[model samples]
Target: MSRLPHRASRRQFLKLGLGAGAVLGLAAAGPDILAFASDVSDFIRGPAVPDVAPTQLSEHVWMIWSKDGFPTPENQGMMSNITFVVSEKGVVMLDPGGSVQIGEMALRMIRTVTDKPVVAIFNSHYHGDHWLGNHAFEDAYGKELPIYAHPLSKREIEGVQGSMWHSMMERWTNQATAGTRIVAPNRTVEHGAELDFGDVTLRVHHYGPAHTPGDIAIQVVEDELTHVGDVAMDRRIANMDDGTYVGTFRFYDELEKNASSRIWVPGHGHPSDQVLAWNRELFEGIYGNCLKAVEDGSTMEEAREMVLADPRVAGKAADTAGFESNIGKYVSIAYLEAEREAF
Candidate 1:
């Protein structure tokens, strides 16, 4: 893997969403609920369930645990990966995983870190698993927390939220519709921004035009901890259908080359330095085969079939629900690069 250069053009990438029926709601457990909160807060073991709501991740940071976890199978995907960063000036959270219960617990944990109040939050991208928790935050902290995102992030997430809610409403009888809404980013950032917390500085890199138009990674600059969002998925396969491949791969390559930090956290999986390579390889294989199928005069449908012909990629595609959505992204991006001779 190599470090990425500046983006060549505007691009938006969205990681696949949890099937509407597979979604979970945040814990709405009454404040008096005890039992698990102490265990979760204590961090006594392996992925605590029946949690105390919020689990600590770093000194002033915590990971919100939905009692049922993410809606996806094994129920431990990105939706369970929500983490909150608290500082004296204010608190900043990244990827507030699905479930209002989890969101509220996250808020409770933020209280543990500091009494300054939550000042803001940012979504890694528009995936419902990441931003659906916004409603909980707003209800608890109000909508003025200055939700920040890329300009396109709001539109993409909102659209998905509605569509996903409808999908869930159709399946689980609105189990997925409760917290769904088109929450927008009040503050839009371009390129990068630096946020300070007493002596700690979180370096935010808007690395999208790959993961999503508004995709960004937050790094604990002093700690050398970089949260890569979905871009550098630590172990899971990278999603490329939202019209990002070349730029993502290129940017990923550049990131590999330029990033010297340690402890890379992903939107979903466990953290790792190898995430850069693992993600790049997966991206390379899928995008490569997708291009080949297209070049062979295959229709998008046929191209998708061709993708299934390759066992490695076929396995990757299995977790994703939208075939055309995936293939179309490759087609559109390839068409544009050829049009501009970006290669």
Candidate 2:
């Protein structure tokens, strides 16, 4: 995978100042370095991530990624990719962010690129890490924005899931989530619905259930860009706690049919079809192995061992330290699902 020019430059900068000067310089930089350093720290402890920037993926499509890892106080609850599309009508945002602070940052970044108002927001899923940032938008504009999501996502945001996410925000972000509230999507979109934003048209497609029950992918019709929210990840193991392994494989097939030629912006990680394919292959292989183990009457622990024994799976675990646990969890989920289906 080719590195972005901006990311390569930041790597060079960090590499050049690896001594005492680096420490002193970072100290002088204060809060900015602390934030930047926290992002870098994800690499050593988990996955290396480039600094967030409003990078243009296509003509009018731009994205800003958050640090790689679970949301935490040090990172200010910014752990998902926030994207926006600029059209003559207005700016359309996807997954505002995880907290008010992150949302404010996204708003500032958007303003830096375009003066147009954000007319619509899309919560691709029900996860708070993707939409809790709605608080910042409402607080900033002093008006409610038209946030859209699948019916399941809207329901989850209004029920126990909403309260659970609110508690998670407070726990993970300390006081950063104080003013944050569950802002449910005002409008609901079903499968194969097209939303016209004047110059740009987004076709919303819900490819069954994958990452979450409400998972939906937005296809930018003109640009052939698809924002697949957490359905796939780049060089990282996806969370399956709220998802199903077989469902992910099904979603991958749908993505291949619809978005094979398009640029895919994931909920986390860099945008690339190769990464998407990698995730698909990972899920396919692991799920297949788990099914075989289940048919062979292996226990969950035995299925986990069999999947981990694969060189590809082992390599991924080595590359991503923090995700090692996710792999085990995924195998367990797959085994349990396969067992239930068999019975």
Candidate 3:
């Protein structure tokens, strides 16, 4: 008897006693069957990540900072910062990294600082990179552990964004994030809700659509620190596809007024009081120029040129991550928003 190939083709079924109709039926169901099989095959846990150690940002807040600004196969999906607040009660986490491996790494780092279990989690937004690590925390702390998010964020995550982010992260990291599951926030948090965790108090602020329709900024009141998530990133151009230039400005104004935080922690970079200021200047340069171009009835290409020439954008171009590659697209988004505002 001849040996069959490792992966037998659909047309090779005749040799296995399958009739032509059976072969056709198999062909019809092949995609779904293969998908299920692939999912089962990929069900194993992702490779373990090395401990990156945590950096203390304040008396109560420490972060496992990812050196890389974006996910890659080499980094294994460790692109977002995992911030945890150690309190007398327990730990409160904000944006638990990006993958199961990263989350496990965060857990290892958290253990280094304190032995307390994670008492709560706050997902900054519906972005998968910021919250997919919820899998590790939930697995460590149990299913009943409350994961919080804005109502809109929770709805979108549980609806479609959860699976969408899981798939995107896998593709982006070349399967480094394989086996990560979609663990949406089980509870909802709204603006102005203050959560007390023993000596540490966290204030939640959501000031309209900025990065997304529901971006949550969590403030550690005692430490004067606020994790702004992707609403305002440091050194990197925030993705404006699901965001608005006008709304982001409004968010900044509202956040500064409401939170009174001195140090702003970002999802992708080092925490500093200047994080929001740096982002604000860059955004103002981009959006301010676009607004001017719209008022002058300039073309999108012309608007892009204006934004590129702005002093705020030009100065940061060399140091900002993905600036050259992403600026054109973001400028276009700003242009459209400017046009809308003009009309």
**TM-scores, all models, native as reference:** 0.65, 0.82, 0.89
Cα lDDT tens digits for candidate 3, 51-120: 9989999999999887888788888988888899999899989999888888888999999999998999
Against the true structure, whose lDDT is highest?
A: 3
Model 1: per-residue lDDT, tens digit, 223-335? 66677777766444445556477768766765655455666677766666777766666566655665765566555555545545666555555453344345456545544
User: In terms of TM-score, which candidate is strongest?
Assistant: 3
Q: Candidates sorted by lDDT, descending order?
A: 3, 2, 1
Ranking of models by TM-score: 3, 2, 1
Model 2 agreement with the true structure over 1-343: per-residue lDDT tens digits:
2322444433354455342223333645677675655444332121112236699999879999765657766676778889999988999988998766678788888988999988889999888889988877877665567889999999999887877886686567543454455677888999989888888999887888899988989888898889998888876778788898878888878877876546889888888756677787677667777888889998888888888887667667766525665777778888888887677
Instruction: Give candidate 1's error at residue 102 in angstroms.
Output: 2.7
State the TM-score for model 1.
Answer: 0.65
List residue ranges in candidate 2 displaced over 4 A.
Answer: 1-52, 142-144
Model 2 compared with the native: what TM-score?
0.82
- lDDT of candidate 1 at residue 18, scale 0 to 100: 27
Local distance difference test, candidate 3: 0.86
Tell me the alpha-carbon RMSD of every candidate.
14.0, 11.8, 6.2
